[model samples]
Target: MIARWTSTILAAACLLAAPVLAADLRPGTAGEGNFRVNVAASGGPSELPDRIGPVSRIKDIATLLTARDNQLIGYGLVIGLQGSGDGLRNSPFTEQSIRAMLQNLGIAMEGGQARAKNVAAVIVTANLPPFVQSGARIDVSVSSLGDASSLQGGTLVMTPLRAPDGEIYAVAQGPVFVSGFSVQGQAETLTKGVPTSGRIPSGAIVERQVDARFNDDTVLTMQLRNPDFSTTIRVTDTINAYTQSRFGKRTAAEQDSRTILINRPTEVSAARFVAELENLLVETDTPARVVVDERTGTIVIGQDVKISQVAVSHGQLTVRITEQPQIVQPAPFSDGVTAEEPSTTIDAQQAGGQVAMLEGPDLQTLVSGLNRIGVKPDGIIAILQGIKSAGALQAELVLQ
Candidate 1:
């Protein structure tokens, strides 16, 4: 019973930790603990510009259009598990894969099933980098594809990773290194992070080169990480100015808000020209944005986010209901039996709202104004959403 309970707990924890969401948890229970809303605030002495300010290198904000990593995925087998592998009765595919592998290895069984408790089926994933040589190795990630309890001490078999085009680009085979761990005992089990997935650093060797001729290309395209007209214009102008000064020719042209075309100069190779252009510093512009993650109570305020002159009132109304049951007995010699009397009490408490003017010329000013209201993160999220609905928030309000 204890083992079953521990297994149940570990299974649930693994499922919950699969997709990670950073959250700040408080020490409290659902009904008996007190919960408060908290909003973080920061201040600066001077207000920053609304649109344009900090200078960034070209490479930091943009990348070559053709230079990118290709995703590779493959079905693989992970062996050397300590009784944590998938059961053939539960996952039939794992059994099939094992059978196929053993048949290929010239080890065929006359029986119906060759049961194994130290093997698991897994999916291997890796990225084939552009301009990578054939012998260069890249990191590979392994995820359990079957009902494996943990992939803690497993070694991945030789798996051929392929691109979406069905062409093999790399081969992965190594011992899996799991960052998280699971501990089990007779009565209890504890799991930290996830043990069903692991990473093997420099495990996959590139089998083929990506189809990219970056150094020999004639027309080079630069793609912006974030699309902005002002930023595009600034980038194009900077590149053109730098080229006109150094090479005595205008080689850079804006193709779109997100794309910039540069004509590879005849005197310089594409690699040298790109190397020179990416280092040039230029200012970048981003749209005013306010990012709020409702699940985690995380609020990220952009530098350009602003709020118009508006009055905000912050308060909360809490209603509590409690029930009490009392057993009543009859007096001596009376013909009354025991009875239960139910008593319930309902109470409502409302906090007075404090109204204050909120106007932000900069992020610091806005944060300071919000801090004055003493609204917590949850309350501040509501206030921000309300402000956006009222069209008072100048930045784009994004809720996650």
Candidate 2:
């Protein structure tokens, strides 16, 4: 699975490289015959955040930036286990929990001594999102709530998952689907991944919906994840321009870096009005940023990233050590016994490379110069840091 995921990511990277290169090469800022003018713009308050729009008709930017899911969790039990459940003797909670569940069903166990080998205590979790109506199904994740060895081929009982408000929002129940398997013998046991946790697709039904209202009064606010003044101004102006042209009146205002307020029309419903506002086109001006993922050796640079004249020199130092053993014998049976002798040797060397010079009048030229010098992600990070130190790079460098 790890290999498959890595391969998929690499394939996506290859496919995205061309478009990303093209976007990086394009010019920023609004002007006739420029890339900025060719890009779509949205109808919202001008002076809002630049991250707000692509100004396209497909509504792709809004969808990409919004989240629509909530986490739901509950404690429950898995019954009908085939000797793979938690040992009730060691896990007393499993026995006590089962007794409580049975008592709820009108089955009385007098002394809390219910020996059940076919049941295992489990925790159930699911995602309950906004707009989810009653009876809508969602996937549920089941994990052993006790000391169970495995949950393979077990059935989870009905469990009510609740939100932070202490209200039951979903009910999960179904056959647990374990992704991996396990085998046990008298002398040996082998397991893969996690045997105590599993998932059930479409195993939970929503019982309630979360309230997420975007319009309740005359003002509607649009928020940006990353707050920037330039981006906010562009967003505000684009919205004002688009709305004034389309509706023959100004209806939006840029409140701050993060929020934009739009006037709600009396003739249109709040939902419909917000929907139309979301669909309006606008061009966005992204801030200059360079993000580097050190662990994965990945570097991402924004289109606005710029660098000045700089020189970079990188060299790797490598050390090598060798050990050789020698056996010593008694010479001519003299009062000596066989022994062993050890020797060690060490050597150091530096990698062969020439100091590279980077000259940049723009972002594209900077990237081209860096790439031409065969600088990998790690090398690029060091070079960028050096440039920033020298007051040459005009962007924020974020390391992750």
Candidate 3:
């Protein structure tokens, strides 16, 4: 009776485990989808003329084309460290800088006797904006140049930041705001992120301004970072239309995908003229591109993505193995020893489901089909690769 009950329980357990194993299997359809299509015009010529700016005005567009900030960098020293600074023994520059600073402070030190653990070498960086006047404050970044453990609670002592022209543009000085912390004991130390670098908000004052002329040019230029011919033409047409209705004739010229030349208006100030140009509305078109990041399983779909007619089927194949151990006992108390023998079996089977099909004729249908099949990101990559191989996918496949 006991043997019969045990066998029944073991069979039930095996039946229960089978469904869990089956749940692990998945089926997915693989194919490439097209991304090229005609983008419908949104917000017409009236919208276009306002999106970019005025056509007769030259100064406003030029201002919009300028760089946001100028990069200023310098090498400096960080002092008053709590034994967390770089070792002077290994870094001779740290010691040399410290000696020079102390000598300025009227403390004479012998060459070999200037070793100290409170000093660190650092690099100072800041950004000078186009309209930054003298005495304007800007944020600055400070990073250790040596093997300093941390820069927390350290003060930057008046580091002069210079631009590419080797002229001092800003002066940086303040308490450094390090992002990480560290603690140490005799046996163990705990650290998080990086404490050797820090930032100071509004810590630098602009000392010099870059000599740049924005309103002096007779022809102002609008430059696009990613020059698209369609976008450039739209910008040019929009500016021309605005000026024709407002100032009498077209004054904006599309020089190329990257540049547009506008004739300055005599009636408006350069600043106000450029302001009106920047407000012009121009509808721009971007190329159809499919970007795939395999490492993180991210997919970005543009609105213009399209797909031709295609069929897709997905299924899964599974293989399973089972092992059972049987025990043999000596009969009737005889002097025979008991032993156990193991039985093993292998089985292969297809998933108990119908294959899913994807039929796509356009971008909407393609996205709907992929979503309906519940395709994962990694599986999407495989499908895209397969589609590309078939010469059906129209967009550029950039895998990163």
Quick one: best TM-score, which candidate?
Answer: 1
Better of 1 and 3 by lDDT: 1
- Candidates ranked, most accurate by lDDT first: 1, 2, 3
Question: lDDT at 275 for candidate 3?
Answer: 73
Per-residue alpha-carbon lDDT of candidate 3 for residues 1-400, written as tens digits (9 for 90 to 100): 3233222211111011112222111111011122111112322332333233223223332334432466778767777888888887788777777766666566778755765677778888877777677889999999998988989878887667766555556777789999898999999999987899999999988877665455544456577655767677777777778877888867776666777666766676656767777876556566666788999999876545555555655545778999988898989869989899888889988752444565555568878878876667777777777777776677777889
- Clashes in each model (backbone N, CA, C under 3 Å)? 3, 21, 20
Q: Over all chains combined, what TM-score does candidate 2 have?
A: 0.73
Which parts of model 1 are misplaced by more than 4 Å? 1-52
Q: Report the C-alpha displacement of residue 7, candidate 1, in angstroms.
A: 38
Worst 10 residues of 1 by lDDT: 37-46
Return the lDDT, model 3, position 60: 30
**Residues 84-142, candidate 2, lDDT per residue (tens digit)?**
88888888877777776666666779965777677888777777755566778999999
What lDDT would each prediction earn against the true structure?
A: 0.77, 0.67, 0.66
